[model samples]
Target chain A: MSVKLTDDVGAALVAAIVARSPYRRALTPMIGEITRIALANNQIRAALADVAIRSNFEATRTLGRRDLGPQRATLMSFLEYVYFASPAFLASVGEGPKEGSHNGH
Target chain B: MAIEADHCDVAIVGTGAGGGIIAHRLAKAGLKVVSLEQGGRLPDDYFSETAPPGAKLDFGIGPSTVWPADPHDSLFVHPLFADGAHGATPRPADGFRHFQILKLNGLQNLWNGVSVRFCEADFAGWPFGYDHLADDYSQVERLITVCGTKEGIAELPDGEFIPPKPLRPADTMIVNAVKSLREPFSHAIPNRKAIITTPGLANSCISTGICTSGCPVGAVYKFSARLLPEIAGLDNYELRTNAKVTRVLREPGAETVSGVEYIDTKTGERRRLEARFVVLAAGAIETPRILFNSADDADPAGLANRTDRVGQGLQDNPKSVLSTSLLKLWGHKRTYDIGYGDLLILMSRGKLPDGSDFPFIGHAIHGLPDVPHYLSGFAGFPPAVKIRMARMMFHSYVTLGLFCAGEARPENRIRPGSTTDSDGVPQVTIDFTTPPAAREQMASMLKWGRKILRKASATKIYESIDNNGTGIHYAGTTAISDDPSAGVVDRDLRCHGLDNLYVCDGGVIPNLPDKHLTLSIMALSNRLGRHLEERVQSETKVAA
Candidate 1:
């Protein structure tokens, strides 16, 4: 089924996923904007749907989790989309002490 | 109509790895040099780290706004692969799709800068061996400012290098683990990369872990960033961007190439530039395509294809990726400074058909920013569970990339298609298949890689074998050989039948070693420059 990700739905998905992340404060504000831009690519959109279906299969068989169905896939797909597309989110979570200078140079 | 001839000594096509070095060397030696680059110069902020919201990002490097929307749009020759299951239907794969980068600096701008020299064994079938090009290799090393530790491994030779960047904790663990293994499998060394590590020469690598998207600070070696500035001020050197060379122009009834015909990409105007000599460094695929496209009634096959070997013997390193999670580093805080380039070189010795020791090389990469994407794909968990798993396992991720030496076979070749692109250049049809022996070697390498990772306390190992063309280190299209029947070029890189046509790109490489091919291409170009300089001086003396 074709799921149109409007700004409100994308924002809701972003809010839900960021709530579970450690960098919730940093990612919550910017992730929706990033996701909206990424979803513009038809290739990425198709890939998201493919990943969602495969994720559902893995969850049901391997993890023994109840099939949360399309809603669950939608939420997981949005999370996957943001994870791959949003470098800002990656940078926020990966922030750490920069090595002052490499090899004492 | 053809434009008026401009005075030029040497006209080089493609301002990439080979062309860039050749232009710099020839220009510095006081010879007039002109380089034609298909793509124009990128903007100053092309590699900037910040992007406006709603901009597309690639691998944590900011907005890819400067890059073409489709990577194939930059290529002069688009490659069609015959990789269908039945092996008859030709289609595009991830490998050839991203193979050629047509920007001013070419693929060098997007390279991860893993600069390792081919070992002595790698020169088995070449007209010249390692010792012949040793000085050239050292010169290119110093020019590019390669960073590594000289471990004196015979299979993986050491080069002139700055101090290597320190290995991260995960890399250190893997290195120590390899130390406990048996001979041949036990050796691991810091990767020798072309990235600048010295403080004063240029901006040093800040370990942003985004080298592939173009180094924002110019720490990584790029022709436009490093060598172009050196030659831009020379009065004898000229670089014409947005000039797409169509073919090498042969002088009537002569065995020498006189000049080149190109299209002004900005205006769609056909132009000709005459020169004393012409060098084709457009790349392995496009170089041969240009030669084939230049075929006429005199040389119906191609200019240098008298032996029908211009596009034969094409090869690319067959690669496999093994991803694993370091059990020891799980739940550790993630750091962005983990080197995006190969952190360490893992060499395993194997036996060739002649019972000679062949070095099988693999690179260990740690803390890639894209780890979470891989995790989210296969984890099969709920959204919250997947997020938590990504957070916890982020620091534990380690990917081992293995590249086997590709054997140059006559069957695996590139031929010009009947149709042409919008610019009137022929599309390329690549008929490449992984040889059975190479496939066996890749399988063996993958198995051995899993063992090494297991030794390093890695869990949940996964292997992904890439399609043949993905290695991107294309070579041996126009191979070098002493016998005219066997190869396209001579030891001096001059085409066997053509007096003034030279090939200084990866096309002249006789074989593909496991290591990256850029540095070797640069070294060959440097050697060619010195040879041409001496020849030009001798000719001038005879004329005087």
Candidate 2:
């Protein structure tokens, strides 16, 4: 989950994520549990939010804003689909296979 | 320190699709443009040498991609992988995943030269749509001279394209079968390619099959040889090769960019380039890397990283290649020259129950001339069956090979981080697993591809189980963002918070449905160039 760049909640989230706040690790298990609960209740968006939060926490710790500094906008666009729009994405197009079998980049 | 004048109105990084177009447009508009290229400024003469894929790796940044010494830092160094040493292999991270993952370290290996356009349904909810960039696409096509016929699909864009290469006999046979099935399949033609048969060059390349080895003649629309010099002669442009830009120096709070820090590769000398604006076109992987490296204590999160979304949400085109063998026909020996391959493009979409379209897009079929011959040897039958295979061939039996490249949904993403490499420079760690939906699509396409080949009475079919990474076309991590949380850059290629800094590369693509991202990157840069021109003009008018 990317910290929404446009909102205060997002800005705070970005700060925490980029800073790798201690609170972030605590939210992971919490988000996992919430994701399960949300899925049981069919609240996909909520589940996705929890996942986003967890991802944001993780992203902040490793990549931080520095790595993505110039490309924050592009990275966020990718997250929108990852955190929120992925399910719908898979529904329409049949997921295809990876192009090459074993070469790594 | 020498106070040399190294200043320009705009500085563009890279010289491929993005930098090339930006230079072309900015120089044409009479702006002082300084384009920096990391590669050597080789004329047409240097490009005439033809080597194998691994041998010619030096033309680009990396060394000869020999096995074990994977000179290109693009692919991860691991045991049992290419390691830049051996033939390709299948390295699927998960067994049950739906889609096939091609194992090229980058996009270059997977591309079959099928050019495609994004569908309106593809960009349905995004900030912009296909029509918005139509004119820009036209500009890109003209600059690059794309080739293909416009299939009247509302979702796909058509343009002034070159005529596609003809289909080989083997491909024609498969096309007949697909058409006979009437599955609404349209054969793909290479959309926007660089190869042109020019008259005046001293060395004339006959369009041999070694496009991967770099075009021998000056026929291809390569960045260094073809586009850069043309853009440089515009008088408004000055190109600086072997100059590595290290940072986008900015003032304290606002997005106003002031200058750049770079190291001249030739002299190992560091210098500051003053510029009103900076555009980063350093491919996908390096673009984000530069951003992260540019971050300092004041910006700890990195220069434009207030949102912390910089290196997340990376993606790659979901790709698959199914190689099958054709039983031999009595009088046939298999051998195909570079240009004799049959190439066709595929474009059609499937709809969901809710009427919204899916992202499983298109594929192009190429290299049929080699497939039939290659397959006859791999029919997977015993030597005793040779007579039987021969008998089958008299009835027009032949080997068939087919590879399919499909689109990856947004969920399949990659991030830029490093692992402990033998060398300290972070080894790119890409964590991508094929999604189920895309897997189902590729499987279906394989079935369809096989079905088409079978129509020609192909006696032996072997879906290739061994292959490595697709070379050099990784994109979609740093895309144009509408919401700061969802993207890394704005629609105009600028970082959300930074006013004068921009990224124009494959990394800025929001989607990588097909591996044909070079064209779009070129188009986006062309658009960026136009925008820069307008800004410069506005500033000039105000000064007057």
Q: Whose DockQ is greatest here?
A: 1
| B285-379 per-residue lDDT for model 1 (tens digits) | 87988888888788887779888898888888877778778888878874434554467888886555555554578788774444233543445
Q: Per-residue alpha-carbon lDDT of model 2 for B415-471, expressed as tens digits?
A: 334342221223233455555555555555455556656665665454532112342
TM-score, model 2 to reference: 0.66
Candidate 2: which stretches are off by over 4 Å? A1-105, B1-5, B41-47, B50-113, B185-192, B197-205, B325-342, B348-429, B464-471
DockQ by candidate, in order = 0.13, 0.01
Worst ten-residue run, lDDT, model 2 chain B? B96-105
Q: What TM-score does chain A reach in every model?
A: 0.35, 0.23
TM-scores, all models, native as reference = 0.84, 0.66
Q: Rounded to one decimal, what is candidate 1's iRMSD?
A: 8.0
lDDT against the true structure, per candidate, is 0.71, 0.50
For model 2, state the Cα shift of residue B423 in Å.
10
